[model samples]
Target chain A: MGVVMAVPRHVACVMDGNGRWAALRSLPRTAGHEAAEAAVMDVIEAARSSGVTWLSLYAFSTENWRRPAVEVDVLMRLVRRAIRKHAPVLHARGVRCRFLGMSDPRIPAPLVRDVADLMTLTRDNRRMTLTVAFDHGGRRDIVEAARSLIRSALPADQVTEASFAEHLPYSDTPDVDLVIRTSGEQRISNFMLWQVAYAEWIFPQVLWPDFRATHFRECLDAYRRRRRRFGDVGRTATTTGEGPR
Target chain B: MSRTTPQESADVFGPDSILRRLVGQARWALPVVRATLLEAAHPQIGAALMEHSTFLTHPWRRLRNTATSARRILDPDPRVRDREVVRLNRLHARMSGTDAQGRPYDATDRDARAWVVATLFESTVTMCRLGGEVLDADAMRRLYDEHRTFLALIDGGSDRLPATLPEFWPYYDHVVEHRLENNEAVGVILYRLLADVPAPPALRARPELWVMGRSVAGPLATAIIVASLPESFSRRVALPDLPGARTLMRSTYLAAALATRYLPESLTRVETFMGLAGAGADPWASVRRQAGKAAALVRLLTPAAEDDGETVRSADRFFAEVLDQTGDGYLRWPDLAAMAREVATRLDLGEHDEERLFQAYAAWWRELQTALDGDGDGRVTRHEYAAAAASLPGSGLIKVADVLFDVTDADDDGAIDADEYHNLFRTAFQRDLADGGGTSYSRGAFVRQFVSFMSGQQHSSAYASLLSQA
Candidate 1:
């Protein structure tokens, strides 16, 4: 008999090392991004099938605009193409798509429209929600939330953590339970600061382009093996729920 | 016994001192978690942290704040350092709370602060020794003495911490062996270090370098922390262990020491000299200040229609007379939903169109509540509604208007006709009026509401005329 494991409700991924993967293969960075399409689809299918309710992918960061203009152009086009290609598949699988942090003017209008269309098409999907954080910066999101609150003319004393959280983008999105940053580079790089405050993290050493469903499942297994205490004492035989300190 | 002069105080960690020589190297950060664990092991410190700190929710942030405070204290500029001392004192003054056992804990307590300083001093030596950058007995003693002086600066008085290297060890050992509690704080940190070790944000962009070092960094740091713990301490607490962890630590720290020797200061030091470039100084502070000034100037030059008292009143009246169909003092989701249903009924719309109108109103309510619902009571007061309405011209709520228009304009036309507009007003002013049976509002009222919704133009006369019609 096997012990039942508690699966995380929401899992977020920072898909890193695409450029590094391309460099390793002596191919253009675009090739690595192109290859990541398979990994994204695979992860989505895996998460949907494995009973995960919410999955967020770090598709592009605000700082990614600092890359060479040519590469940025290619990435924007590639992302649009990927969205167009995956919309039907995602909708059919009942995966609701939401684009977070889409405030950047550099994002093409047509791509924005396409994203809106995708969101509307998948609006009623209840199986899973796939939030793609494009042009997102955690710091920027926080600043925007603050700005929005100020514009609302809310009294200072009335602002609580719960109220402040409601001002953030996708306020309905639940806190992330697990954050997997591929390529074994263990930096958060300003992704979802408020959401991932207490999230467990996994760095898998594999570049995102090469990540597969097996790796995803392995990470989920690792998550189950670990215990989450959230500041309280854990349940152990040697120690009562309350200890000396 | 005598007070040290300013010159004498400056001599601690001064030029040619071993403490200064070893302090800021990037590799020193390796034992930071270990030092933190040691500090938390002290019962008072652990109890205080558990009571007052957001350590569980924001562990790295807590660590960063500590680092920032330390950096400011160690800043070469006297003004910066002194300012930080004052800040630290002020901050510690308020950090008093009770632990789970109802024992009061004060962060400013001498023994707890002393224990914190002790861990820092001991961890520095351990970090140096493990990495093969050996410090002699004299250097260790000198460093310990320097740390005592450092403590005096922070404590704002003579050092009450253990005065000498010999005295410090027994004090440290006794606490580690006996007094240290097998608490959850240490367990959580150790678990995090082993399972979710994150690189500092400073190293975020250096993926290749981090990847090369990550395999060793997390496990090695955990191993060092575990190994550094005394057998009694480890036994008392459920300290985690790794197979061959010590071997891994030895090899990696040796390589790291070699790298430190060969690498440039930029690669080896986490922080450089204190100046404008220091981490304590935000590089964008000046830019942000200038931008703020520019924004203020723009506001000054722009039209003041948005801030007009009449505009606020107009919005207030609209909330009371239009959206508050229940004649209640507060507007809630049901009011908005009912308004949408009324508009659908007035138009004699199909079920699908009715649902669309309801969804639009819900979306609008969500946007408004997300922005303006300060107390989050699920009800928007007339004042809150009016305040939000005053700023509606260019805000995201304006986008909500577009959504509402799209849903309500069922004919696929770009605009709503007078009949459609009347339907909206009829739903809005559904509350029983004293005059009764006269639902038709003047064209001035219609134009005024339209301008507020579409163009957001504020006119006192228009509002007065609209109020007369209402």
Candidate 2:
């Protein structure tokens, strides 16, 4: 509606190079994750400052499980930490916390609780939704939605594109208006498939750990520089909507 | 502690994430863990509890006392009777909100759970010891449902389900666990019926209400539920193995009613997030019980709800009978797709000019094809999917919720709760399926759901005329 609404209905970020970021600094990958957590604060605040409402950050990925056992352990630990670590700030900032892949209760019950608690605390906060996609696969979300609809007692022909949103992981997290993939990755890597369809893509070369408010602002500047068009009749080539990468 | 201190706030975070560590440990060591948390905060939990009447209430007091008691059992040598006391106390503590580790309860803390599974022998003996409490229509119903474990059977073999079933969804036969096989391709027609009913019911009639956690179902809906109750709260519902479930429909019915009320307690109960654990689970239990207690109070203090044996039109009953298993091939998924395409094409609405037709049936078909990455027999056909999309009330803007369902079905389990639902949508919509090519409309099951959703709205409106007197 206004710049207030221009705050990306959805924003996805590819938090890349955690290991490399750690390795370059001669620290444990966990340290990098820890550093990344700090960076998360920076990006999130900057996004909120820019009037972006929903920020979907790509933290741990489904493929990340392929990493060394030690690394995976550290990541899971980091995940648990991140969940508890951000509570007060989340409550203060009026941001809700949700993880895309970790739904089952068996998936580190404590971490799950923390994530859930944070979300519960900020459930009423309309400021913005900061979604952390952990071990989430974009393709999986699409298929899952299909399957869920199929199982519902609700009728089939009744299903529609807009209707499906009610069943998604980040159902209320707005449409992706700008995508910023750190470490210069051009691919969305199966981040948000359905919601990001029309989001504008921006690739920043800076490694994730090095990324800061300045870089975040740069992305916003870039986002402001472009125009968004959701495949309609009038707008043709230049402008596109924003979404998180 | 006045206004704000960024550094102290930060103290609770990072790799130095004390809260996280505390939460993780709380599951295993509740008391010390909780005390640690309350200690970290100003003015400990015991003190906090003293300040709030919500804690002094029966349930909270029992919960608090048990937690304190359990901390005693940790010692090596406790008398046999006292040890027995420990077990009984655990049960009492749980109801009070204390964590399993005998720590103070923080309803908001995700990791803490006041688990106290009561043993059968003790509970049975306990029931015999304490006389039951019964009040009026609502109270009796509430207590009956919450307490009655054994139910006597009458005509039907299974008394588990309500005698009178819902009409439109006859496919709900407890069939094949999660898989319901309707010989008739009811999915297609049902979807259509759901999408565009001649006159849909008001929103309140539906179990899962809209955004604000409320169902605007009219008074008629209540009357309908009331009508279904066997008119006798003591009807027997025998279970095959475990003690027959309490015939007490009061608790269950009230849960549904409370859900319809749109209260915060109901919000905690219905909202998908955090629903599985802690206070979030059965958050509405208290609300329903309170309503029951209020009903009891009213019987003592004022006029209770009066039910006239006078003849009332059995509209819901008639609809239920007519709605069930008509099985005629009235509408199909393909028909819906065609309709969606027609509508989208007519509207000429799209986010970008090129994608204007993207919301159409053809676009839906392509999108579905792409999502499948493989072809299937009844997969959402481009036309079928688009029809669903174009059918939803929204014009051009993509419903973020719809996009969520288009993703997130890892194993095809069929249904996703709110949390899982949100995760899937976030992944797909945010990721844009990798290259950011706009998501297609054929993944439009959500649109169909929306169509039927309007029916609840209609039903609620119908009920409004009758209930306004209350």
Candidate 3:
């Protein structure tokens, strides 16, 4: 069948299998992480070209702190270097940069400053918003949102789904429409729980380091073919409008 | 992040999340059937079916169609999933008729629509509860909100819908108390369905099968249905509280849940119904088989060739003759085997075809056994056979026409007006004949086309030509 695409406004990705990719090539995991930068660039270009307004990448999770201290250090340094190296290019391409997740002290002070600076620098860009979720947990985000709501002393009846969403870290970003996870992992792993309530999920076999613009396009095409019901019935062209009750 | 966030995390449940797993794991088939019966209890819908639906004549077909629609509603793609709701809305838009009391009925009636949504909600909750999941007030609220969101998609908006879960209860209770009726249509349909509990081959061939089966199974089926219903609704429907039966059902559900928990995800998940919607193995293969058996039974029972002195002319006559030979309603395997041999000999089967003919006979008996046997117990009782026999005479062609006309006649004026006719054509063929410019046929011409189509003559040339172009 021909691809009749309906591009989602926002696409979130769980980039997995970097360690596996490095292991497969008999290289250090750091090399795999470094290689993933190219894939990220390619995906950003693809998202911009495909009319995607928001691209949220699961770059780091709260659980990542459990890794070896050396690996964690290497990852933090890699994140800082990637931002510094690619900020100019991303800004040039009119991509707005934002950091998501908790403002924990565990995420080095200098890295946090760099993230703030980069976000400030690219705040006015219009082409796309790239949200790198470092030290993020979906559960954590919800907790923070609830805390904010409590702090504001909102009335009990005022806590609607729309209202509750506003307290999240990235309130400006819309809910995720598509969540793509690489290396064939099917589970959500607690990523963007609230945002991906109705999102279409696609799990491809390619590792994070190998995922390219072509793979991204393929995922989008696959998404286009799906019929998103939103828990409602399907309608066809011949359907007649029902009279009001 | 200081081990974890200091603030408490709220659990998020979505379509692809754990909530789907909960729904998937639950044994929903029985609850769904119970829900459908409850929905049909509503006077308007019951009356609508009595007048315009072929459900009684083609029960399995109607059920399969409903299952297909339900599967589409759960489809992953929002675009494809919403089509069934749209179709229902469009169909309902044109649906208007009179009830048994001569009161006008419209599908868009707010109360009628609300009752339908209530049935869906109650059934899902009932199923989840039966599957050993107890919802707290907050969880129930969330579920209610989710269903409201779903209803909004169907009803176009939530203006007429209740604002909160608590507010919905009284409205639902009121509907159940007053609006639902123990109408003839619902009673007859439910009785027939209950009576036709398919049994195994051993029980099916028994003499006076239906008499014995109905005696034992009929009351049991009624008790189960009663037990499944809410207490107030049960009383309204004049069904006694079957406490013992309810206990049995609970135990059965508990056992089912335990077994399902151990089973693979592929087995528990209600993916697609008959491979109609999603990519997966057809989970309803048995239902499809039953439908095929019902169709064959209808064909065989219909009067075909003229009766000869020796040769069987119709399935009804053949079965009667076999029953006479046995001197009881029960027909043992040996009796059926003998009958098969005799029929084969009468047909003068060639030596090479004899084995194949016997195999066919065996296969037919097996299919009949499967279709009649509601319980997997190898023995089929008389009631099971009677139930299968009851469905033999298919809904006649005229009844089908009546149903079609009832649906197509938007104004219920006994005639299909030009606009209604075009609407019917578009709905049936999924094409707009007037797209080229104006309707090529007049009202009379369109009526002629319908007549020709109903009579099994050549269909409308315009329709045929249009279909060919696509």
Can you tell me which runs of candidate 2 are displaced by over 4 Å?
A1-7, A104-106, A153-158, A228-245, B1-470
Question: Residue by residue across A162-225, what tens digits does model 1's lDDT show?
Answer: 9988878778999887899999998989999999876778899999999999999998887765
lDDT against true structure, model 1? 0.66
Scanning candidate 3 chain B in windows of ten residues, the lowest lDDT window is B1-10
Tens-digit per-residue lDDT, B1-470, candidate 1: 32222232343456665655555665665666678788787777877665445444333434544555666566666666666676566546646766667778788998788788888887787777877776888888778777776677778654566666777788888878877787756876676545444333333223444566877666666776687665677888867667786776667667767878997876666553221111233433443344433333233233333223644565666665455544346777655654554344335455455556666667777877887777899788877766666555443334445544555455555545445544443223321111111223333333334446432343223222222111
Q: Backbone clashes in each candidate structure, one number apiece?
A: 1, 122, 36
What TM value does model 2 have? 0.37
Shift in Å, residue B406, candidate 3:
24
Query: Considering TM-score, where higher is better, how would the candidates rank from best to worst?
Result: 1, 3, 2
Interface RMSD, in order shown: 21.4, 16.7, 33.7
For B1-470, candidate 3 gives per-residue lDDT tens digits of 10111111222234543233444443665666677777788877777655544344333334444555655554556654565566556545544678768978776776666667677777777766876967888877777665555555566655455778777888778777887888866686567656643332222222244467777876776676667788887777776775599986676667667767787767665544323221123555444344433433333333333324421133333343332122233433433343333333222233334444445445545655566667866444555655565343222323333434444454666655456654533322212211111223333434445434322242243333212111
Using TM-score, give the best candidate's number.
1
TM-scores for the candidates: 0.41, 0.37, 0.38
For residue B50, model 1's alpha carbon misses the true position, in angstroms, by 2.7
